[model samples]
Target: MAGTGKAHLRSSDNAVLRVEDLVIEYPGRDGSAVQAVSGISIDIVEGETLAVVGESGCGKSTLAKGIMRLINTSSGSVNLLGTNIAALKGEALRTVRPKMQMIFQDSISSLDPHLKVNALVEQPLKVWNRGNEEERKAKVRDLLTSVGLDPEVVGDRKPTEFSGGQCQRISIARALTLEPKLLICDEPVSSLDVSIQAQILNILQDMKERYGLSLMFISHDLSVVRAISNRVVVMYLGKICEVSPANELSERPLHHYTHALVSAVPIPDPTKVSGRAVLEGEPPSPTNPPSGCRFRTRCPAATDKCAAEEPQLTYAGNGHYVACHHPRA
Candidate 1:
């Protein structure tokens, strides 16, 4: 039902989600505003996983929330399936909310601790009046089994009874109840153990294929992003610094910020010696971010121009884009 109208500017026919110049801010204690997400644009084509990576407070999660319309936005538009969801209100917003779903990082906290797993997953179907009681139960059972959980055994258990990994699987099952076209995963595997992380990731991949879904995966872990994402968007202080294919970004980063991030990824080969780019100090406060380039303060290659003139995201060959005045060769 999405993408019903004519394509707007910068909206791709193939994209399931298109965000343009999106800005989100909060009222600071003082009179000023705290800009959590600066003007940014991105497109996620159908069936592609677009990974958003950055350090803490870099606004990755805020971007995800903005896209989902969980919070109010100051300006810009979020076009989902050709509908500008940012402008939708009340029933209109509720109508489109079912098309996109979000999975949070704290799986246990995200679930309703008092409700049984079957009820939790079936609630969406009930709200939408999708099926009869027996049909809803059958769908819930299929969803639980698809997520690697045995519905017959775990269906009646409350969320508190499950481990973190199992809770996440339940969360995924709940999100898929409506068969959403888009799944926004905000650090969905960060809290689980390494072994458990792989299991959840595998399930997500399986679900994506089974449901024909597009994913917006947000995380701080580069290795995990590399493993699951097709394209990667690197953010710094609420602004995107680079966008590139996942493999290309890992192997050859163009933006200095991206270069530093890639360098921090641990290499598996003991014999391969590589120099790590250690950034100095912490990210500047978003309320009073630095002029020009947001990342210039910690970038080793920062020059006077970087402090005076803002650099826009420009192509750096082979579909890679970087927002840097002096991009690395």
Candidate 2:
């Protein structure tokens, strides 16, 4: 059984991106197939920030690449801005790419070290023929300024000459140059300092409002995800276990896995002592996942039924959904 269900997926016309029963696989050892992402479905409405939080190797980045069509999926459909991304090929795929953009985890590696900051940001516009040379340059300056960088000071410098945070800002400017309707950020702030992370997150929120865009933010940091996302999806192994409002997930998690994840987030209370481990054990290999519930192996409440039957997402209350034999809610 995979993580969160279609129970919460809305049919509203405002949805910018939708993934239905998406399954992504890779060739494992001995030519066997490894399911990285398994039968997951999610939707993002216009102007909404959907945060995906999970442990490392939980298919967060893989899901992002799948939606971006950077990697081919074994089966499923990715509908973006009224177009079926999974069905696109060559020119058709290139034509719809401008409407969606991705900001990777590695800022320095993502940018071209040889290209100047101005040229890096303006390249997309020039390739798309967005406007004349003067117009493109003006837009680049505006984007840089909006991200709190000066065009005159940093425009001519290459990415190798700048700091990680600076390069990330440049990446953001470059991503925004196309004015994409949807942006998928894969751990965008995880590599920076705490203060810098705050700054970058603030910039993303500002850009979201200014550009009228929707976002799919993937991070392992629950606190960061809760602080910025409208809704949160919790994944374990290759499946999603819970989907809930950010605030509600923090306060009252439905699934046991969700509760364990919430409990793992550090609480900055000086007077309080260390907390007990609600969750135990590592995840199973994706190449050979456990039968029935993927999380039952680690769940304290696991039962014979949990071992025999895979649970589907059942609706709770207040827009929360969980796939667990024994949900906390």
Candidate 3:
């Protein structure tokens, strides 16, 4: 089930990351367990940007953190380049950590305020013992320039001195210090202004090509996801509702939930305005999600079967996969 989604995106045998039945649970009030991610599976092939899209509390961030081993997972395997790092600990985890780096949503807060920009970017290299002092300094200067920052000017200052966009660029440079094969961006541009978002996205695209990196991009912004992603995984209450090529998903979203999400993406042209899928209520509590299909509670097209039997993510032709019982045609 994990590798199946990859076929629907593209017939790629070179998967850089494979997540199988990944589940993440947190302690809830009164000793209960809140499932943040539930049996989510995905694959990101080499040089492909797989965007995980959903509203807040949809487990997008949790999934990303789980893959990076930032937080403990309840169950499942996270395979990176064929090694199941799910249970790896201590030295084993540390050795492979440099190969996968994450960019957080809050750019400024994620960076160390005390450290200068050059030191911050060079920290990964120093920790990993990549090069000598002179070599590391030259590498840092080159990375800063690649991300559109002047090393001599901005490298001396702390993250406080730069704008949100500049700080994010610094973060990108820091993440790329190891020349990581897989980069997981967890809402990296959500905090910036609309104009700043474009600049950051462009930098990310350029960096991906330059570094030959596969990206696991997590965001609630469907429009941005469409712009940057090759394939998209639509999450609802911790489960994937759809997986399709970015352009196909935007123009012909299969799942009802995905349709609602795509419809909400604001159209620039007034002449293209059409009726949107307005979801009726808020999402259900993760602690006690709806039985059968987790999204049945808020799904307008849900029927008795949707409430009685869980729908698995199955191929829906044209390299599109959908889990909804009543998918949109």
Candidate with best TM-score:
2
Task: State the C-alpha lDDT per candidate.
Answer: 0.89, 0.89, 0.88
TM-score (C-alpha) between model 3 and the true structure: 0.96
Cα lDDT tens digits, model 1, 46-126, are: 999999999999988999999999999899999999999999999999999999999999999999999999999999999
TM-scores, all candidates, are: 0.96, 0.97, 0.96
Model 3 misplacement above 4 A: 1-12
Which residue pairs in model 1 clash with each other?
Answer: 3-81
Overall local distance difference test of candidate 1: 0.89
Q: For candidate 3, what's the RMSD?
A: 2.2
Write candidate 2's Cα lDDT for 191-220 as tens digits. 999889998999999999999989999998
| Candidate 2: pairs in clash | 3-239, 3-240, 4-240
